[model samples]
Target: MSWLTIARWDARAVLRDRWFISVAGAFGSLVIAAALVALGSVDVLGVSAFGRVAATLIHLGMLFIPLIGLTVGAVWIAGERESGSLVLLLSQPVERRTVFSAKYLGVAWGMTGAVAVGFGAAGLLLALRAGTDRIPAFLWLVVLSSLLALAMLATGFLISAGSPSRSRALGTALLVWLALVIVSDLGILGTAMILRLPAWAVLVLGSLNPVSAFRLAAIVGITGSADLTGPVGLYAADRLGFAGLLGALVLILAAWTGGAYLLGRKRFLEAVEG
Candidate 1:
């Protein structure tokens, strides 16, 4: 009946899921190990240790953000619904909106924590190895990483809520991820081929993809450089500054989350009664 009650239940459900813990643990360990290896190979003495640390965190965080966000979050609710547990939970005295909000908060918070651990582990290793390169970027890394994670989780939650079946929700989520990562590049390539445009044109279009923006944001935030040179990379270099790209990512992600929620809100209600 109460929002707090639903929040508690949602938290309990997420905590009990072995899948969430297993994936989080594996990812966190792998990222931390990779960062340590990188740090060991680089020369840190008399170098900007703070900058190295920041760059490392951002670099590693970029790879994991979307994976954690979409892959893990997408299935949270849809899986429950497919298993018939979501309906059983809602059939309790809890309000539907409250149930949705609580579940969102639980999963979002849980995911954010997982990402923080992964990034934090990487940061610690960098510190131990590099002593610190650009410390300021650490602040940016934390804030941006959290937002990135939230964006992923929220999008997944929305899709899960709206889909008629778990398979559909997961398929759509994976498709969206693929489109963000690889499809955008393919689209640019296809367009450039058909249009016979200048090389710069292809470069520009690829940079505009949200995934490119996120990658550039991570690079710029950590290294204080944007070296986009080949295909989509070059376009990113020309189009976005460090701040501009991050701002764009925030805006685009917000739109995705908001739109998903709007659709989910309607779909959940319809499905509940049906």
Candidate 2:
């Protein structure tokens, strides 16, 4: 079958999965909760009303997006292999690379749909409650969040490819999620504290990680000033400029997502169809 055909099938399957609704609902609830919470708060360091909620949601997005993206991706190939579905699909005339590409494309679209609902709902609510002016910034945050989700999903593919079974793949995915969270935070802190790297150097190193890059970019959206993100932000704002920082963050995110997916696909081919 053609790649498009396979991708359509996989997208449909992923979107229709039982957990999909729950995922969407979780995002909606988070937005509503954050909106209500923002109303009670006095100030988020002088950020606009929408900015306050957006800032809170950015952190929540960082946590939720990666978890959902990685977990769903981790289960994808591993579950298929464990269930013997991969073998059945392989029996078709399609090439293994085609299968991998199609599967990822399909799943990416499925996930995009779910995340759009979540982020979109937040934007809509903010527009109604806050105003339409900052909608552009929130929309930009949505784009960055989508990229971050894709990056995590790509990492999950590597986990699923290397793993021999679904449970192991899922477990590995969780450990990986925790490692990235811990390492990205402590790792940055350690670099600054132990290495005594210059602020510019530390900011550059921090953006190397997709999650960090996303957070840094989101900071601009929330605060309209990267300097508010702390010293790293201050350094980047002075040395790199906002345009430079955005360009660098986008490039880093693209590299992580593309590099991880290609590497994972190669491993899957060797392991499953070698």
Candidate 3:
């Protein structure tokens, strides 16, 4: 089987799904709405209005994109297995790896498309209203958000490969999201506070979370200074600077995406052969 053909078919299938459509629509609406809301934020002398919008975009994009990628991906394999479709598909002439990789490609394309539309619309709105000075930062928001989505997709795909049913995959996906996005950040911060960790140490702790990696990149892009992120930001600004931090955070995300996909692929292959 041509993996490209399967990938394209899967992308079309994802686009046609009502749940994905609704979620993408909501994400797009939120992006535009966030830009509009950020316009009301007070702009300091040196900062462009679009910079403020980028901040809001970062928060909203990070929050929702992970949900979109993970929840859908979590069911990609498990749902088919539960319905007995996966067995039928595996019996075809196509190799298991083709199906595994192709499905991921198709789904990734769908999620990436959604992220682009949402962030692109927000960027355009900001450019029109606040001028284009911060367009680069807005672009960074899109790129970082897309990376985070892909990383989350990899994680959810791993979960799907091992899960027995859609319900369990979904429940597990939610817990993963909660742990990475919410609990990890809060727990790290509280630990830093109680331990009186230095700014550099807090920065290290934050980078371990994928969401925080995206946030670090976003803060550097939008504000041109990590100080906007408070104490950790302050240290990042002095020690690592923009290029350093952005590169580091992006690498972290890339590692997660690659590592999870490799593990998921191994499990999926075993599942097919079993």
lDDT of each: 0.67, 0.81, 0.84
**Which run of 10 residues does model 1 get worst, by summed lDDT?**
228-237
Candidate number with the higher lDDT (1 or 3) = 3
Ranking by TM-score: 2, 3, 1
| TM-score for each predicted model, relative to the true structure | 0.80, 0.92, 0.92
**Candidate 1 — which residues are off by over 4 angstroms?**
42-63, 196-209, 228-242
- Distance from true position, residue 78, model 3, in Å? 0.9
Count of clashes in candidate 3: 0
lDDT of 3 at 109: 93
Tens-place lDDT per residue, model 3, 1-274, is 4788888988888888787788888989988887877775534433455666666678787788888888889998999999998888788788888999999999999889888987888877777767777778678778888999999999989999988999999999999999988899899889988999887788888887888888887787767777677877777767876788778889999998999899999999887776
The whole-model C-alpha lDDT of candidate 1 against the native structure comes to 0.67
Where model 2 places Cα greater than 4 Å from the true spot, the runs are 39-47
Q: Which candidate is the best by lDDT?
A: 3
Count of backbone clashes for each model? 10, 0, 0
Model 3 misplaced regions, further than 4 Å: 40-47, 194-200
